[model samples]
Target chain A: MKRPFILIVAALTLLATAVPALAQDATPTPVPPICLNYVGQPDDIRTSYYMGEGLGYYASGEFSRAINSFTCVIFEIDANYAPAYMARALVLTQRSDYERALEDYTRAIQLNGTDLSGYNNRGIVYTLQREYDEALADFNQALELDSRSVVARNNRAVVYALQGEYELAIADLQQAIETTGIDAVLADLLDPEREEGTPPIRDYDLIEAQPYALLGIIYSAFALDNYQAYLRLTGSNGDFRIQSAAGALESRFTFDLRLDDGTWLLVADFAPEG
Target chain B: MRRTGLIGTRFASSLPLIILIFLIGVFTAAAQESPEPVATPDPSGVTVESCRELTERTAGALSIRTDAVAPFFIGLGDAAFADEDYTPAIEAYSCAILADPTYAPAFMNRGYAFFAQRADPLALADFNRAVELDPALALAYNYRGMLYTVQGNFGLALGDFTVALTLNPDDASAYNNRAVVHAAEGNYDLAMFDIDSALLIDPEYPAVYATRSAIYTALALIDAEAYRSRAGEAARYPNGSPIEVMGGLESAAETGSFATWLAFLTRR
Candidate 1:
């Protein structure tokens, strides 16, 4: 009887310990983040309405009135409204007022550092001003916020190419192509559903095409340099022939040498076989 | 033998208590395995009027009226619109368009008045004409986006809003409206990001606050539904009733941000 009682006591203790351990090991399910903040206010309505009016003015191509509307929102309604600055900057940019546009972009960035467009557009303006360093910095910052951003990478690549850093430019462009998969972008552009109506081409198609065009230009430059160097070194009056061919997935370019006697020789082919 | 008998009796007497302890431990473990749903605050006050107000406030303006008579008619139209007189505003804008057939603002303003009167097809035609006359006019795109939102064409609405933002990045209202659309689509993360962006642009935007509250309420209800589904028949509030999880349907019936959100959802 005593032995049986001891056994029962041990069994109960074991079960108690094991149950809690099992509970502790169980994983909790994830839930979406919830916000608990103020709602139902009249002032927000009026302010948003005023902003819509300003946008309406902007859409109607009434630059001065649009500017005034946005300015009113900034000065009279809410000074902190970052969108007004951004809107005003856009108009300024359209009117070739880069100086004020820069100021507004800077202010918008200050208000909202996470907005990728602010950085990207500011970088573009800097590029337009020939401020390559500023442009590069802004593009880099934008890329840091979103590493897979093809636009930022492409913009950075443009700056690099402008600075004659072809290698870095090529690397950035290649990475962008990899991240976005140019084929997929092209597929979207060529999707049969788009043929139902005369829909405008998407920006992705244009953006995806840039790297290929840039790469071709860069490669052409390299090939041209080699041809020039060959001419200088060998003092040969041979005609250099360049031929381009397009494939289903890629474009191929080959450089060749032809003597006046009609003898052809392959010099170099930069593009990989598709 | 006598000592062993006493020990056995004592152990037997405590056996029931030991079993009760074991049962308590097991039940506690089982409870811990399923987390209780966090109580969500009621999102009760946001209204459809706020959204309507936002839309109504997007009145068109004629900034560069080249024609002499066009400017006067535009001014008249603007005054009529300000006085909540859609018919006269539409007429004045139409006269301005007649005076200067190429004036894009007249078309845009007329579209605004048409929208106010719920003449969607007419408003859409006017907006399309305005855009055709002046592709650079950001306000036309913004107004068209609002019309699209009302028409339940979210894709077109989003595209137009994007164009408006691209044309004028400072349009806080565009961000707010886009956020509203995202919330309606159950894209809570995107909704939160847009709402935050709107706040960054204008910290005191009341409509954004209302939208945020609606999003929160939606999230809470989603969480509650998830909990109830996971717990099945065993799920219950502190009261004897099961979790009362009213989706966007019930909330939409109430006038406010949720109602606006429901409109978007149902239309989609």
Candidate 2:
């Protein structure tokens, strides 16, 4: 899905650390090579050559130069190269040229319907443009492609948050966090053939905390909306407080409201999935 | 004479106390015999205070007692971590660290546990201590670099990532991480190079694919803009036709002069 910017921010706030002793591992790791080699395809060779040049200029911070190289690949090299269109779209997005970016994304999607990122990124652009319905549709399409995609769920949550649908947002965020937890648990439970080659399992709490906080934020926003609606109906103000207590596997988000009678009443209790 | 002989035989046969004392003496002697040594033979010449240690050291040759020590707790932590029982793993790692603060692996592992828990501050502190104790620990630097990158401290992140690469050039993850720094700086070329390096080291690594895809996409847009300047339409592509730009290329190739200029511009 369009890279989950929130998760990126959250991960930055909460991150894992490790980088040594991959030497002992036997697994064939995938590296980010130039990928110029193509078997039995002379045409693909030309494509990679241009792609490599485009990538090089892009990496050098020459945005305009990079765009030209990629465009040449798209127009002069091969019009069917979905990756070239996708690449150009990314640069356009970076430059805030959302119109062309959206077009490129759509073309990329048209060329390769199986790639979910195209839909997800287009959905992001739609959301940015305040086209909530279209954004939701694209996110839905992505989820249909992969039901278990956490990135799609999170992006959809963003759309929901924008629409003041806090409940759905909370649900999506909680699901993303829970999925991560489940993944970590499952990874740990499985036995690898060799200990040295296996990637170390991460701690669940590290991954769960920020999403949990985000869930709480959504709950708070929802509570505020309810309180505002109540105030509008009663023509009076009320005191409200949000309290949270986290357990080993779950956390409780409670909103307590004090009426004119001086008695505290429970308004909302959201126990998001861990 | 026969009656006197019978009386003597009866007196000899009626010595019950003497017979009982003789039996007790035999039983006592058996009880007092030295018991066989309980201590098992140790070919490794290592003294084991607990059965846990004995069994672990002897590979199940001996198991008679349960032991809780630094190494034992470390093993427990490692097991819990493998099971994704992060809470128990952290607890076990804590115990290991408590037992032996100087143990670099314990600190490193505990730091990892903290990281998994999303306790960044705790994780960072543990990582700091781990690196302090063991300067050669490349993983600590790599992790710290990840943390720094997330925190948006690209400078520190770059330093840590570079250090990790210096220590182990084959660390594909470090190369990928360094690429993230380059990407953040808008140096897409270097970013792609680093990612490519990572791919070369570990061709199966999945994360680099995403990064590579992103780089390719970003470059396309950036270069598309450059296409405008050459076409003399600084605002946009001519009639929104990207194909029009290729018109001059065929003629440029024949003349060599225009082709050289186009190549320089494209390469630039």
Candidate 3:
């Protein structure tokens, strides 16, 4: 028994010594290399790093810094990068530098033909410049690309309004509102990955200005006079405020009148307390 | 045999330590195989020039010119206002003004932010500065008129509204506002005419209908049965108009500022 036990102890010691040696000799599994379309293409790390830096700066409201990072990728890393151009163009739009913004947008479009945002954003610049026909054409092209594009459709509505085609404008707004819901286009302007700290203001898209303006125009044109007609058309008493010229009594009342258009006009009176 | 037993006991004592060493080797190898965690960029005090430096340090960095740093902050303010974060919006607009003192929109928007925060004195100062900087800004006149109206200075309110109208006749909301002033002065006929004009401009205006109803109600109180009958007759569109419009008037306090007015005027 004693001899066998001695043999077992010797075996245990040998096994313990060999286990570590075996681990040392074992070859590690090789990591696969990141795939690239072509062998001579720029290394993915530098390109991705700058792109990430650009986006990070943008989120921090350092637009000029963001532009610099994007510029580095375009000039140094890859001249053909469409996203760099597009991002730069968006920042330029906020600056109201329409001409250069248009140029950058055009370049981005040239780089990537299928992207709808390039056309849509360029059309917004056109709208801001009051280049209505050009704006319409771009909007139409974007629509053809994707009929359900809320951004393009809302933009088209603004164009119609600018042209003084109220009916068509209202129709477009109704459709856009129904399909995408109110303030849906506002979503595109927001960055989802933005941190929860104080965020910077984005430029107002004129598309957001259409519906209310149209509503005001519509109510103005109808001129509903009868209280019932006013309620039938707009289901609320139009109460307006007025401070009494005689006493400190402020009163709220609905103002209505009969018009030649065979419509009843209703307005709210808001009277302030003295 | 005694020596053999001693060796066995020593081997058993060292077993746990040997196993611990083997586990440590496996863990170290795994740690080596994993990629390093990326460091997040420091966002503190990040500015336009700092960004330029980041690119300049890199190989092949181009010298690019950027413009309208002021407007960028104004946009930031506008965005904060949209999110209903009035404090940050005020700060952003202030930053915009600092970047470009001539930027009238910054003053105008800052005025709006002040109004939203109930800082009336500050709002008045900014609005005044906005009009001084750009007299052609119709929105400044519009909001200033609203402030005058709230303060019971109807004369000033009327003057400001008239100026806003003179600047932009297409402002349907201004027409609606002027009609309110007319009604307040007990000039019902003039009020009726202004309301008609507002309706002519924007038939879809939800508040005008309510304003129109108030006019008739006030008219009825004056002549009682006669105006009431007229109001009732107007309500009858032969067999009665189809469809009911439902909503409320946008408070002047809410739509008083140009920036807030634009937001409210465009709300669906």
Candidate 4:
């Protein structure tokens, strides 16, 4: 009976101590999920290991090794894995085996209609081979299924630009910028990185890209203000535009200064890269 | 011994009431906690400008707490107008007025740009509607008076200029414009008085000097010396000024430059 009384007293004291804190934390918090970038673990470990090794090789600039690893995963480890086949085909594309890459991409798309990566990869291949109309149609459908789809938007813009529809390309990019707030969509893809299994394209980060957009916009706006000031004095539209445009990560730079009496003068020399 | 033990048991039994009180306090505390703050959407919806954006119209986009999306369009239009790109500016301003039944500034701006573009009829229509929306719009009355004078409607011009003058006593443009109408009707005294009022507000204006010069020139033509030379020259100055010395009609009918010029000016 005494033990029952002591237990009752202790329970009452604990409840009194905890009630106010629980009451203070009554509002529910909104937790957004972390978006994943790479493929996750498959049911089979050998195929997963092969896929992981391939990705690691690709990330480390060993395109040949990545291609070899992915092909082994596709042929020997798991014949039914769509991603394994897709990864091998990407290696073929890096090696400029476009015909074989197109076949694998088509097969992947046949198996899964929702995998935007397959469509985007094929569309890029179509763009490189100059099958513009087909590429545009595929990009348009990709955008329709996923309006937040920046890859489809950017690829379509590239096709439009190659077709001499500069304004249309700019318009599409503008919409993509507004939709996803990704400034890299507007960045020029000057260099095509190639290796055994790596795609001959920059691995532009397409994750929640608000920071990239904000930084790009701020940089461009600053350049605009500076270029406009220069234009006020020089009145050369082409020169001002060239000075303000974003260059490749690696590019040579030259500066030519002309004197009042038509003499070539050198004022400054600097490279154009960030 | 039994009585004291019964009393202690009664005290122990009151513990249920204390536990009930504690739970009620916890429940009350939970009830007193404030709800989480929600993220409210912007009341002014996203305004899609002409360049570097999506669609032109904000039709499907809802601006919270407003049925009039016209103001946002009008704001976009105003920014374009400041850039002096009048074509897109006019399109935006027109859409703004179409969205709102009572946007007077848009009417004023659209009228001004149309006038600059030499679309005079449209300018007149907008100015008229702006004044109708608010009769006390002094700038509208002044512009309407100028348009009427350009079309040779002197009586209407005078009335509008008078109304503008009544609203803004310091409006020198109204006085100058009214003086033009007076000079047309040959009321030189009233015309000179209006010119004087305009000059008081804006001295050293070259156009005012030009107007006064024209009036003096007309007055000097009736002097005795001018009458003799003009009549001797044998040309009948229209408005019934008679010329006594001229060649026969057949002799003077070679090119007919003077008569043609006179006829065109008369039509105007």
Number of clashing residue pairs in every model? Answer: 15, 38, 69, 1
Better of 1 and 4 by lDDT: 1
The lowest-lDDT stretch of 10 consecutive residues in candidate 4 chain A is A265-274
DockQ of each: 0.02, 0.01, 0.01, 0.00
lDDT of 2 at A208: 39
Per-residue C-alpha lDDT of model 3 across residues B16-53, encoded as one tens digit per residue? 74345435433432343232222212112334464344
In terms of lDDT, model 3 sits at: 0.58
For model 1 the local lDDT of residue B152 reads 86
The sequence of per-residue lDDT tens digits that candidate 3 reaches over residues A1-274 is 9999999999999999988878762323223323221124344434554554454456456666666656766776677777667766766666676777788879877886676667777887787777889978888887777776666776676676557565776776677666645454344436586555533444444544445554554444333223334445544443332112111211111223111111111111111110
Model 4 per-residue lDDT tens digits across residues A23-83: 7633222132221211242435445444544543454446665566556555565556666
| Tens-place lDDT digits, model 4, residues B24-100 | 43343234324223221211232334321311122111101112344444444544554565666676566556555
Evaluated on chain A only, model 1 obtains a TM-score of: 0.59
After TM-score superposition, what is the CA distance of residue A53 in candidate 4 from its true location, in Å? Answer: 60
State the weakest 10-residue window (summed lDDT) of model 3 chain B. Answer: B239-248
lDDT of 3 at A107: 86
Candidate 2 displacement at residue B140 in angstroms: 44
The 0-to-1 C-alpha lDDT of every candidate, in the order given, reads 0.61, 0.60, 0.58, 0.55
List the TM-score for candidate 1's chain B: 0.61
Query: Candidate 3: where is the Cα deviation over 4 Å?
Result: A1-274, B1-68, B225-268
**What lDDT is reached at residue A97 by model 2?**
72
Alpha-carbon TM-score of each model against the true structure: 0.37, 0.34, 0.34, 0.33
Query: For candidate 2, lDDT tens digit of each residue in B184-259?
Result: 8776656766787899999999999988877766665667777776667646553333344445555667777554
| lDDT by residue (tens digit), candidate 2, A8-120 | 87676554332343433342332333332222335554454345434434443555655665676576657877776766676666666778778888987888787676777
| Model 4 regions more than 4 Å off | A1-251, A255-274, B1-89, B95-100, B204-206, B222-226, B229-268
